[model samples]
Target: MKFLAILILLLNILSAQNNIGIDSLQNNTGIKNNLSELRTELDDIFNDPNFSNAFWGVSIQSLKTGETFYKLNPDKLFKPASLIKLFTSSNALLLLGSRYQYRTEFFIDGNISNGILNGNLFIIGSGDPTIMIEDTFEHWLDSLNHKGIFSIKGNIIIDDRNFRQDKYGAGWLAEYMEDWFAPTTGAFCLNKNAIEIKIEPTKIHQSAQISFNTEFIENYEVINHVITSTKNSAVEVKINRIGNNIIDLIGKIPVTTEPYSVYIPVNNASQYFLNSFYEFLLDEGVEITGNAVKLDEYDKNYDFNNTIPLFTHKSEQLTKIVSEINKKSDNLLAEQLLKTIGFEIYGYGSTSNGIKAVKELKQGMGINPNNFIMADGSGLSSYNLLTPKQVVNLLAYMYRSSEFDSFYKSLAIAGYDGTLLDRMKGTKAENNFRGKSSFLENTRGLAGYIKSADGEPLALALIVNNFLVPSQLANYIQDKVCNRLANFTRN
Candidate 1:
């Protein structure tokens, strides 16, 4: 009887093991079927007639399971546009740390006596791009007043040698050279090196009032051709810059239209910096006995080792600046950061050195150099080329980095803030999807992170190039992809 009972017990145990195996197999099959469905839907979406002629380079990977969910020409090179800012921001975070600060120092070649400076005031720029007329210059004037030095007897020299004098990115369109988005970069930068032009319609058949946003004086000449039209007329305005600071306003504005503003790139950022500071100094009752001159034009030179330090200005931390680059797509700031990385790593603040620094950082992250070509830190350059797979791979790598929190938070959140504020609204992707958006004439890209319905983290890169369709159509496709991914579940 005991042997028979033991035999039955062994058989029961074997039966239970077989049943467990069957259940596990069934679950695996279900998962495969679900993934297959996901792929089919995505394929149909991308195969839409509107995108039939466009190239869609897409890559999506599971951050939790290390699984590639989908890929469409993932290894093909495409113009990443502003999406290149992702790489630039990541390189900065790794090389400079999130807490890194840019410092601009004030030095003197002479002594201060009887409320007067008897020598030149040398301002050395360490590529602090965020200096503002109100925030930085005002405080500086106050500090000068506190020190009892209200008058200067020597020249105000700008030592702008920290960065190369490359004003424009290579491969930028010639037509956009004077646009606000194409502002020149220099070691000594203020107010992003751009000026805002505010236009308001007065009366019908009258000229529109064009004014500068900042109170500081500028030399740009505006030949106003824009006329106020009927109250119901559509607002049509055009701006043209010719012969160094001459701007032509050629269009019409309706009398009922609200104030319209556009930002224009300054002619000379270094000179503009000086002009702004000079205006501020004069406004604060400070007397100057010498002209403001850049070091390149100044005939006299002084040894840096013998100069006495006066005051120093520090910028917001790197993380805040990175937020400006990715979220707001600030081209000038991005360029400044690229040059800064070069200065910090290679002892020169040139675009070439910055590219080298980024390449080195990418290699450290195990990204293949052959997969992409980086022309500039800001995606404003059409010379930048990247593969979707490589971008997603980079995102995955960042996800595992210690600075992931800072990097992730820098991206624009869909329907909430930054560049993606109006996109993906009223969908599952809203507030869940975070990414960086880029647009050139014919290119659109979105790259960043999202969490699936099952709570699985994902990194995605979707780039559309060579499309003749309107940009809204391209945006629709990208937003749809985000919504689909945001609702994806493997459970």
Candidate 2:
């Protein structure tokens, strides 16, 4: 009787194990079907007539299960534009932690005896891109005043040796300099290496009143040819920067129109920063006997034993800075961060060094180095080539990293904030998608994460190039794909 009872128990245990295996198989099959449906929907979207002649690359994967739900030419290269910021930003977070802060130090080369004996006031820049002239300089002046120094007996020397001499990225077109987005780079950047010009209409037939955002207005020569017209007249303004510091304003503006403003890139970022600092010192009642000059070459044997440390200005944390880069797609800031990463890792700041560091970071993340080419950190270069699979891979890797939260929050959220403020509103993607948007002449891309109906997270990369359709149409297609992903469910 005992032997028969044991045999029955063994049979029952085997039956339970078999049933569990069957249930697991059924769940896997259901997931597969759901993924297939998602792929079909996305394929239909890609097949639309508008994108039929365009080059499309897309990849989507479930972050929860590590399953690829959809792919179309996932390994093909395409221009990623600002979507390259994802790599720059993510690699930055890994190399320099979220708490990292850029420090700009002030040092005096000579001794100070009763605020009279001084040689050169050195401002060593650590590439703080967000340094505001008004606020930052004011703080520095206050610190100097507190130190009982009213007059400087030396020149203001700008030490920007941390970065190389190249002020622009590779593959940048000269015509692009006219736009505010293409500001020159510098170790010590002020106001994003650009200044704002405000033009207001005056009396009829009279030239418009021109004003500047900075007090150093004398730095630039503006030839105004604008005239005020009737209230109903068409307002047309043409701003042309003829040369380095010469700007011509030619157009007509209605008297009733509000003041029109435009931002122009500074020809010499280092000089502009120095000039602005000089103006601020004068405003703060600090007198300098010598002119501001750049330290182009420094003797290697120079001793700093007698130099006095005044004060250091710490910039906003990297977390906030990265948010600005990704949200607004700040090109100049992104480039600066790239050089900074290179400087931090290889002891020198240059575009090549930065790209090398980025490659190293990618390899460290277990991504194949040859899969992508990053010519510039901001993707402003046409030479930048990346595959959808590579982008999704980065997203997935960052999703599991410790710095994921910081990197994720830095992305633009649909219908909420950042570059996506006006996109995907009132749809399934609203407030459900967080990603970066990219746009060039004939290219558009959207890559990031979306939460599905079942609360499953999905990593996605959608890139379209050489599209003859309107930009809005491209954005619409990308939005539809995101919406479908957001509504995806396994029933």
Candidate 3:
């Protein structure tokens, strides 16, 4: 009788934990799962005109029990764009620490005789790109005019060695160079390495003249053929290279009281900087007779002299840069961070090093680098490609990281900040959704963490590629699918 009772008790215990039998079968072991049903719904959603031109991938993993909730073409690679910055910022903080600061040094090469330096001037750059963007050239000028140096008796030298000179990305789009998307290089980028081009109304026709707050660093002739338009639209005046040092500005001017000048890299950057400083000194009651010169090393003659120090310039905080890039989706900031990482890891500011670091970081997470092709930190490049599965995998791996808080803190919040500020409104996904947004013509992507109504924590990545439809339609489709996921009542 006791033996009979033991057998019955064991059977009862097995039946109690049905997850091993009925539960497993229901979750695709015992039977087909809701996941399969969700996929069908997703397909219907994708076929809608709102999503017809879209090439998309979505991977969702349940955080509660480590199960995949839904998936569609998760392995297909598509451009991730600025979403790639998640890798750059995360790895940078991981390997380089959270408080790493790029250094810029002021080294004297000549003796200062009665506040007059008789030696060459050198400004060494260590990849601190954000300098003096707060106002204009005047602030930068004042920062360097300290110690009462009336004149620089030598050439103005710039040590760009902090990052090796590699002009641009290897396969970067040709037309991208003309866009402000093409960033200015060098160890030190003053004012995002761009100058302001303003077009304000004048009392006379063709009387408009070019102007910048900073003194001219290089003498380049510029011709403005911009016709003033009667409309109040904002029109940009184009600047083109004529020969070597000459730039021609031509375009239509809108009837507005604003100034516009495209800030471009000065030709022969070293000499241009010297001339600019020289002009500033002249304005500030200082005279500089020496020309700009480039040399191999620090001038040994003036290193030992007790030269008076000029004013110092401070860099924008790393937190601020991250806020701009990760939270605000600033491509320029992403580009700058990539350059800074390249300089730190490979001794150069090219995208190659940044790409390599991201690849390596993915490998560390046990992922294949081929799953995604990273062209730049900012998704502005048409060349960047990432699979939906890869994005989900990255999000999952990052979620498990010890530094996950920082990573999450960097993402744009839904209906609150970043690219999703206007998305998921008036829905359960609102405020509950934290994700990154990507957009181009027919391309759209959203990936991040979420919680279903069933109280299940979930991680998801929804990517759309080749989207040719209107943005509103695409957004509507996304909203519908996301609503489905957010409303799930079970794991």
Per-candidate Cα lDDT values, in order, are 0.84, 0.83, 0.64
Residue 400 lDDT, candidate 3, scale 0-100: 83
Total colliding residue pairs, candidate 2: 0
* Model 3 stretches astray by more than 4 angstroms: 1-40, 50-54, 133-151, 203-210, 213-222, 231-251, 254-278, 296-314, 454-456
Consecutive 10-residue window with the lowest summed lDDT within model 1: 24-33
For model 1, what is the error of residue 243's alpha carbon versus the real structure, in angstroms, after optimal superposition? Answer: 3.7
Which model, 1 or 2, shows the larger lDDT?
1
**If candidate 2 were superposed on the true structure by all CA atoms, what would the RMSD be?**
14.4
Residue range 1-491, candidate 3, lDDT tens digits: 98897677556544533322233112222222267776786777676663555676878888668798877887877777656776677776665666666666566666777767787666666666555534434565455455545577776676665554433444466545444555545555655545555556554345455676466535667667776665655575777766655666777766555665676554333344445555655766766667555444444343424544454455655655666677777665676677778767777776777778768878876679876688776776777777777777777877887767767777887668877787666556767777777776577777788877666778888777776544555565665566566666644
TM-scores, each model vs. reference: 0.90, 0.90, 0.77
Best by lDDT: 1
Tens-digit lDDT track of model 2 for 370-415: 8788988898898899999999999999999999999999999998
Cα deviation of 453 in candidate 1 (Å)? 0.8
State the lDDT of candidate 1 residue by residue for 62-160, as single tens digits.
Answer: 999889999999999999999989988988998899999998988887888999999888888888889988788888888887777899998888888
Candidates arranged by lDDT, highest first = 1, 2, 3
Root-mean-square deviation per candidate: 14.0, 14.4, 13.9
TM-score of 1: 0.90
The reply for model 1, stretches above 4 Å from the true place, is 1-33, 213-219, 256-259, 299-301
